[model samples]
Every structure is written in C-alpha cells, then in structure tokens.
Target chain A: MDSSPLVLTLASIILASTPLIIAVCGEILTERSGIVNLSLDGTMLMSAMTGFVVAFETDNVWLGFLGAMGVGAFFAFIVAFGSIRLRQSQFAIGFVLTLLGDDLSAFLGQNYTRIPGPVVQHYAIPILKDIPIIGPIFFNQNVIVYFAYILVFVTWFWLFRTQPGLRLRSAGDRPEAGFARGVGINFQRYLYTIIGGGLVGVAGASYSLNIKIGWAEGLTRGFGWIALAIVIFGGWSPIRGMFGALLFGATKALATYLQRTFPEVSVVAFNAIPWVLMILVLLLVGSDFTERVITVAPKSLRRPLQRFLKISPPQALGSTFVED
Target chain B: MNANRWIRWVWPAVPIAGALVVTSLLLFFFGAAPLEAFQAMYDGAFGDQAKTLSVLAFWVPLLLAGTGLLVTFKAGLWNIGIEGQIVMGAIAASWVALRMEAPSAVLITVEILAAMLAGALWAALSAVLKTRGNVHEIFSGLALNSIAIIFTNYLISGPWQPPEGGTFRGTAPFQPGALLPLYENSRFSPLSLLLAAIAFTLVVIALRGTFWGLKLKAIGQNLRSAFLLGVSSEREMILAMMLCGALAGLGGAVRTLSWFDSLRQSISGGIGFMALLVVMLANYRMFLVPPIALFFSAVLSGSITLQLRTQLHSSLGGILTELMVLFVLLFGDWKKLGVFRKKDDDG
Candidate 1:
C-alpha cells in the first residue's frame, strides 16, 4: 500500500500506452477513409519483426523505422489491390492479408528470435523534463513518443482544417457528393490507407527498437486487435484515438502492477484484461457512437468498389489507378 | 436467361478445377511430379485401408467444424471463433472424462453433450454481444478467442495439471474406457466417423428442409428484407451462432475422445480458420462441405508425408493451403476481369 508505487504505476501506464497511441492514431486515419484494414495486427507484427531485424543488423534505428514502414506499405498495397482493384470483399481480403502477414512475419523472423535491437534513445526537454510528476511521464520519452503527439495535432489540423482534409472527409462521408464535385475519392482513400498503414508500421517498429528491444515469436500477441478496438473507442477521430490508446495502455500498465503486487493472481488471466475491456467498450458505446464516428468515415468503405454490389466502397480504395 | 443458368452451375466448379491446377504447380515446386503428387495425395488419403482410416480420423473433426461454419455463413454471421469454441468443448469433455468412471456408453454420451454445451455457451456470448450490445460479431468473436486461449492455458497449466511432472503442454491422458473404440485394430475410430456423418447430414437437412434454415438464409441474404417480413433477425442470428458452436464443440470432443489422449495446446490447430476456408471454397454449399474438407485433409496429410519423405518443413502444408485459398478467393471474383467480358455490340 505504498503511495510511491501507485505514482510509479501511473507513470508507467503513460509509457506503455505510447505505441498504442501511435498505432490507433494511424488506424483512425485509415478507417476514416472507409477502409477497415483488419490486417493492422499482422502489419504491425511484421513491421515489428522487420524493423527490429534491420535495426539489429544495421545498428540504425532510422533504418528500422524505414524498413517497417516499407513492409507496411507493401502489405497495404496487397489489401488495396485485392479489395479495391480485384473487387473482393474487404473483410475477407483484410482477414487473409492479416493471416498472410502474420505467417510471413513469423516465417521470416524465425532466425531473429530474441535478437537485441538497437535501443531508441530518449530525449528530454530541459525545462519540461524538470516539471515534477507530469514532466517525466510526458516530456521524457523516445523521439517516437514526441512524434506521436505531434502527429495527433497535425492529423487533427489536417483532418478538420485543410482543403485536402476536407476533401478526404467528403470522400468518407459521402463519396457520391465528392464524385459529383469532381473529387478523386478513390485516390484519397488509397492515399490515406497507405499513409495510415505506414504509420501503423512505424508503431510496430517502435515496439521492438524502442519498447522491448528484442524479437520473439507471436511478439505482438494481439496488440493489433487492441489498436483496432481503440479506433472505435476514439470514435474514429485521430485526437480522441490517442486518448483511447492511453486508456488501454493504462490498463496494461495497471495489469502489470497488479501482477507484481498480488503475486497470487495468475499473470495469464491478467493478460485477458485488454480483450475483456475491448468487448465491454464495444457494448457500452452502442451504434450511436459508431454512427457518429463513421459520419466522417469514407463513404465507400464497407461497400464493395464493384458494380455488382452497386453500393461499394469508393471507386478506388483498393484498385490500382494506372493511367492508360 | 440461359447464360445465367449455365453460369450458376459453372462458376463454383471453375474454382475447384483452378485450385487443383495451382495445387499441382505447388507440388511440383517441392520436387514431386504433379501427377505423382496427385496420385500420392489421393492414395495417401484414401489409397489403402490404414491410410483411409487415418484420413477419416482427420476428416471427422474437419467435417464437423466445416458444417458448423456452414450454418453461421448461411445466417450471414461469420463465427471465426470456432477454434476457441472447439477448445472449450474439448476442455469440457476432457473434464468429464477425467472425473467420471462411468461405462463407455454413458461416458461417450456425457462427453458429447458437455462439449456441445460448452461450445454453445461460448458462442452465445458473442451472439448476446451482437444482439443486445450492438457489437460487431467479428471483432467480438476475435476478442473472445484470445480470452478463451488464456482460459485454456490457465486450466492446463494450473488446475488440470497432470499428477506427474510431465510436460506442461497438454492435459492428462484420458482413461482407457474414456477413449472411443477404434475401428477393429486400426487407428481409425468408427464412432467419430459416425458422428461426423450424422452431423453433416443433419446440417444439410436443417439448412435445406427446415423452416428455421430458410429463415437464416433469408436473413443472411438480406436482413432488412427478412426483418420486414417479420423474421426475428436477432433470434435467428443467435440460434445460428449456437448451432455453429455446438458443431465445432462436437469436433473438439471427437478429436479429444478418439485421436489425442489429452488436450494439447493448439489442439484445434487452425482448423476453425481452415473450416472457414472450406466454407468459402464450397460457396457455403452444404453437400460440398465433406469433399472439400476431405481435400483439405488430404493436403494436410500429404504435407506430413512430404515432410517425412523429403525432409521439408511441416509448415509447408499450411503455406500451400493458404496459397490455395488465396487463389480460390481471387478466382471467385474473376467475373470482374475485362477479358472475361462479352464485347458490347454498338450499332
């Protein structure tokens, strides 16, 4: 019952939630464009492995970040192509890509198990770092942690204020209206999904190079699912998504604290906390939240891009827009 | 109109044929001749008495799981948590088998019921979330899967730990009488096959002949229309999920009682996902379920043979199976291809 431990516990929760905040923010952008990339989990896992492996080999964390983003973009392209161009079900294609991504990552990462990754050094702002309890928890974090906050503000500004952001929102909200206005709805979806996926990939790389600093099989263990849930919890807005990530991160941090404090409680049972929380959140939010969040979502998302479905996703989310 | 009739029957058959050709090419990559691999696969799966029995041993659980998936798909609900349900079923059945020292007949009956109940209850949670909480069934089911795995791990590693200091991987072995009687002296068990066959037939009948089955199909095809017609969409969805869970649970039970003496980690071994693939490959057709299940069973059984004969990785089978699924999915939508289109004759 030491109050000191509780304070430490609160600090660690913010730290644990950083990667999730980064990932969910990226997913929020992706989903806003009307594409539910179920492959986020697999993409993150693969990127985590690739990023760590490259960093381990090159001893450059930047290379790890780049490698992770590259892999994420590549997988996103597959999903986009399969569902968008080929006119397959996004859910099915996304699910397949996820399975493929997971298997491929595991297969490729077989040799890199437990390999140490280059540690991402933390940078503390001089004045901010010295600001008591809030300073250490917020200001003193790895470069990615700072980037995550910046990205949230940047995303918020771009999504609500910029012309391109307005256009993207229009495409998500009502593609027909966007199409009538001569907006390139499909291109916008493709742009956002790939960008969002790349960000998610970076988050995965952060897990290995910054957070854990090592590779292992099934290393992600369902962080991707948590990120997916966070997107909904955030009500599909980038800024709110960050808060959702913090909530999940806090829960995870608390679970760790509990496991240590109450040794009698099984750690395996404790691990189920996030998933149980996800279900509860989904139940509590109801469709009203979904409707509100998806109000700004891309119009063509759940709809197939094909003529058969007639009410498909944007004409171009998954299709390759090759100029003839 | 004539073309429509032709394409309806022709479309489904096309993917199966395409799958075979692609699968042949994959076999060739492993340094085995395409024809020989086909022969071996067929022979290995059904060539001899012993092999056929082993195939049946694998087929029973797959068939049961696939039929369960078929039910959910018909209701427009994708219960991907079948793997989790299967594990819960196996755990429940094993719990009873380990605790009770009843007669073989009574033990078998009780185990099956326990497995079905466990599976149904597990699926019921997702159904409730979908109906009452308005949660998306897929995510809810996926989240439940992790929780189920954690619960299973807890049971095996904690309370269900065997008396001896054996490997902490699986539960304790079942008693001699607890096991299903084998088919004569062979490794194949008649009881599992009988259950699978009965389950498959029942599913087909339920889907095609029963009023409930028709309601599920209507709901699946168009929920709004079905609801307008006074169909209780929520109830139908829940019932479909429950039925799906029960079948998957039975698969788990059979696997435990007949094949493995104990419940191992990953006992379902991606079979639930494989069942999803089977349902997709079969176009959600009920009668086509068994053959497709058998085909997948052959691919899996052959991969093991290939591994033993050629020293390849056992996971090669999974890779190949995934490849087949990928190709089939892409091919199913081949109507979108420009080349496949008839030229428009503008006057």
Candidate 2:
C-alpha cells in the first residue's frame, strides 16, 4: 500500500535483472552469429566463482569482472573452436563444458566459499537521483546497473542501426549469402561467440560483485538457463532480451514478495515460480501451439499476437557451415 | 588389411594414454605427486572388499542412467532432464517407502513401479512438450530440472521432515522394511548389483539385436526416412524417452530403497550428467556402457581417498573423466583432424 515499498521493489527488480540483461544480450549477439552456446549456466557459475575469487584476492571488483569475462570468453572460444575447427557438435561440447565448468568451479573454488569479497560500490547520480519515481528506480544504483542500462541501448542500436550489425545478422540468417557478398562466415561466428561469451562472463561477475554479492556452491543455480530462455522469449533482440530479463526479475521479486504473505507455502516451492512461469511461457510461445492459437484468435488480435510471440531464431543457428 | 586392423586397436589407446599424461599434469598442478595421487586412486578403488563394493554401489545408478541415456542418444533425443527424472523417481519411491503400510514384498514392488512411472511421466511431459507443444526438450528439461530440485528440497525440508525437525539433511532414515537389505552389512546389497547388471545386459541385448532397438536408431538417424519406412516416430520417441526415464527412475528407486538409509538433498548427485558422459565416451555402444560406467564409478570412489589423503578435491575425479572425453574427441579423431589420413571413407 505504501509508495516507498513499491519504489524499493521496482528498484530491486532493476538491480536484480542487471546480470540477466547482460547475459541475454551476450547470448543474443552470439546466437545472431549463428552459434548457440548452451554453456551459459556453467559458464556463469565458473566465472562467478572466478570473479569473486579474483576480486577477493585483488581487493578490486573491476579486476573480478575482468577475470570472469576472460574465463567466460575462454569457455566460449572452446565451443567455437570445437564447432568450427574440430567439426564437433556445438551442443555436445557446450554441454560437456557446462558440466565441467560447474564441477571445476566447485573444485577450484573450495577455498573461496563463504569468504567476503570486494563489492560493487553503489553510486547514486547526483541530480537524477532526486527525480521522484524514475530517479529512485533507476538512477540510484551501482555503476554495474548503470552500465547495464547503457548496454541495452548501445547493443540495440549497434545490432539494428550499424552496417556491421546488418552484416552480423546476415551472417546468421544466410551465411551463404553473406559469403557470396565476401563475408567470412565462420570467422564472424567465432568473433561474436567469443565476444558474447565475454559479456556472459561480465554478467557472471556482476552477480558476485553487485547482485548476489558472494560465491557459494551452485552459485547462480541454473539461472543461466533462464537467461537462455529469455533470449528466445526476447526474439533474440538485445533490447527485448533486457525486457525478458526484467520480466524474470519481476517474477522472482513477486515470488519473494508473496512468500512474505503466504508463509505456509514452502519457500523452495515458491522459489520455483520463475522456472514454472518460463516453462509455461515456452509452451505458449511454441511454434505449433502459437499457430493453433492464432487460428482461434479473432482477426484483429491475431496479427498483433503473432507479431508479439512468433520467434524465429537465426537461420543457421546450430548447423555447421560447410562450403559446397 | 593388417595396417587397418592395427590402427583400429591402437587409435583408441593413444588418446587414453594422452589423457593420462594430461591428467598427470593436472595432478601436478593440484600439488600432489602425479604418481602418488594416481596410486592412491587405484588403491582406493581396489583397496579392499569394502571399497570395491562401494565402487559397485556407485556403478549401479550410473549404469542405470547410462543404459537409459543410451536409448535416447540412439533415438537422436537429448533427455537432459534425466537429472530431473532421477530426482522424480526418488521422490515417487520415497513417497511410497515412507507412506505405504503393506507387506515388505508388496512395498518393494510398488516402490520400484512408482519410481519408474514417476520418471517416465516426467520425461513424457518433456517429450509431449517437444512433440506437441513445440518446446525444445533441452529448454523444458532444463527448467524441469530446477523445478524438480526445488520441489524435492521442499519435501525434504518442509512437509516430509522427520519428527526430529525440518532440515535440509533430508528425511530421517527409512524403515528397515522399506530399504533394500544389505548383504553381510556391506554398504550396498548384492541384489541391487544383480539388478543393475541384469538391466545392463538386457539393454545391450535389446539395443544391439532387437528390431525395436534398430527402429529407435533408425528414427534417431533420419526421422523422415524412418517414418517413410513405417516407423511410428512420435510414439516411438515417447516410448524411447519413457524407457530411458524408467531406467533412470529405477536408479533413483534403488538408491532410495536399498543404496542409502535416506535420500539426501543431492540424491541424484550429478549422476545424470555423468551417465551422459559415459554413453558419449562409449560412442553410443551399449556394450561399452558397463565398463565405462564402472571406470567412472571407480574414478569417483577412488577420488574420495585422493581428497582425504592428497588434499585434492574429490571433483578431480570428475575433471579427469571430462578430460579423457575431451582427449578422445581430439585424439580419437586425429585422423579426422588430418593429423594422418587413410585416404578412404571407411574410417
């Protein structure tokens, strides 16, 4: 009933979603290059652990972020390397790496568990922080949150407005066509995959440094899969992925909020709300189901509804490009 | 012909040897003498009857999971939700084991069936989502795994907490009648081992020799062609997933009913993913699944001593297995990498 509680909740939602927004944006970029890196969960866990450990050691959160990005990019590079050079299944290698990375983080991070690390310092923008609801919601946050906000606009503009962005989209959609126009298809895939992976690392770092604020076993706890799902839900657009991330954050917040009132509901079961919602979202957005729904939908609603939910991934998303 | 035969035998061996060298390097990084850590691992696995039985006990769930994964891999379906399936099976079996008031034999039968049905139903949900709902199995599986884990955690820490109190340690030890009886007070029962061994043999026989197995493989390889050749692709896929789910379910049921006193929060304990590694390492060869599962279980059992004795994390065992698979991917297919070529399509 109170405005302050609503404002604080709104602010927390934005704060919590910063990492997911970064992760989904990274995945959008990677998938746009026609490579699907399914190692997000493991990558995030490993990088989060590494990031926290580095920050704890160095007494600098930025260094932690850098270390995480490097770790993430390295894992992503291997996927691209295996898929492009070794001619292995991207899904297989990525899957194995996810498991390996997760286990490895647990192994290597034994010493770092529960130890306090340097945290991302909050910075409230001077003039903007005073601007009523908007200022309290967005302006009064850490540098990472600000960076995430900026990243949304920057990536969206870069993807939709820039010439290279068009070429990147082209590479994913029809690499053969891109190749005909003199684009090096595989090279682009490798480049974007690594870049996206590094971004994913930063997202992981944000969890330890800014959001969750520490490392633990199973840190992130399969939340990376949520980011992956958000990418599809976002229709693979960086801006839309940010919205999806926010939506997921809102769901988590709602679960936490409702848990306060409904104490009888088991906390663990309530915590599963986001996942259940995601599965439902995927079911509803599914191609065949949507087509059926569109048929039943009134004529006026069908177009807008289809436009809202129809998600067509990059054409060469998983296929290994072999020159004929 | 002689050279070709030689390459077939030697090629696989080369990568394993390469993996040994790489793993030794990793051990050195872990600050344990490579030879010392490996020796400890060997001693731990075959140290005594107790240790060896422990390894076999570990192998039971692994082989159960691997056999089910075998079918899915052959069917060209990735049942990544085996982890959740395993958990679901345990949940169902636990539900019966704790609540049922029946004769021991009847209880055991119902427990096993419940676990299998629970696992099958969970997997079928994913399959239904895949076939009818247009959701990819991977996504649905991933989501379900989290949901299942949270649900299990709730049951353990919420409603089903032992009379003592609610805690994450899992439910208090099940009644003796609900558990699989131990043989001579060993960590596991002989009957459990026999069951896994029998299941493994049957799965191998069915996958290699049966027409049903061939059809699953056919559907996996080319669904359109298989359908054209009079295969029921959709129904068969669901059945394949269910069979795999049932196997994983049995893994859970065995672990609950016999293997352990009670379910831990990490009841599945990453065995689902490990089984995937095993099946992949075996190159989808059902017969190879047992040895590979055994090898992994040995590595896991052995690594416990590595942790206690050498101060290395037990996860080194998992890391070592992963490295071997990576090496196999690299060096097993060195010829494909054009390190050397036979100039023939046979390889």
Best candidate, TM-score-wise?
Answer: 2
CA shift at A247, candidate 2, in angstroms?
1.4
Against the true chain A, what TM-score does chain A of candidate 2 give?
0.94
TM-score of chain B of each: 0.89, 0.95
Where does model 2 sit among the CAPRI classes? medium
- Score each candidate by Cα lDDT: 0.77, 0.86
Alpha-carbon runs more than 4 Å astray in model 2: A1-3, A296-302, B1-9, B341-347
Q: Write the per-residue lDDT of candidate 2 for residues B219-306, one digit (tens) a residue.
A: 9999999999999988988998999899899999887776677776878988898999898788787788899999999998999988
Model 2 interface Cα RMSD in Å: 3.2
The 10-residue segment with the lowest total lDDT in model 1 chain B = B338-347
Worst 10 residues of 2 chain B by lDDT: B338-347
Off by over 4 Å in 1: A1-11, A264-267, A287-324, B1-52, B165-167, B184-187, B305-313, B340-347
Q: Write the per-residue lDDT of candidate 2 for residues A1-324, one digit (tens) a residue.
A: 124988999999999999999999899999998999988988999999989999999898999999999999999998888888778878787887888888788888888887778999999999998888999998988999999989889889988999888878877899999888878888889998999999999999899888888888778867788899999889898887888899999998899888899988777778888888888888877758688788899999999987887888899897777654
lDDT measured at residue A153 in model 1 versus the true structure, 0 to 100: 91
lDDT of 1 by residue, A201-242 (tens): 998988888876778766885788788877776666777778
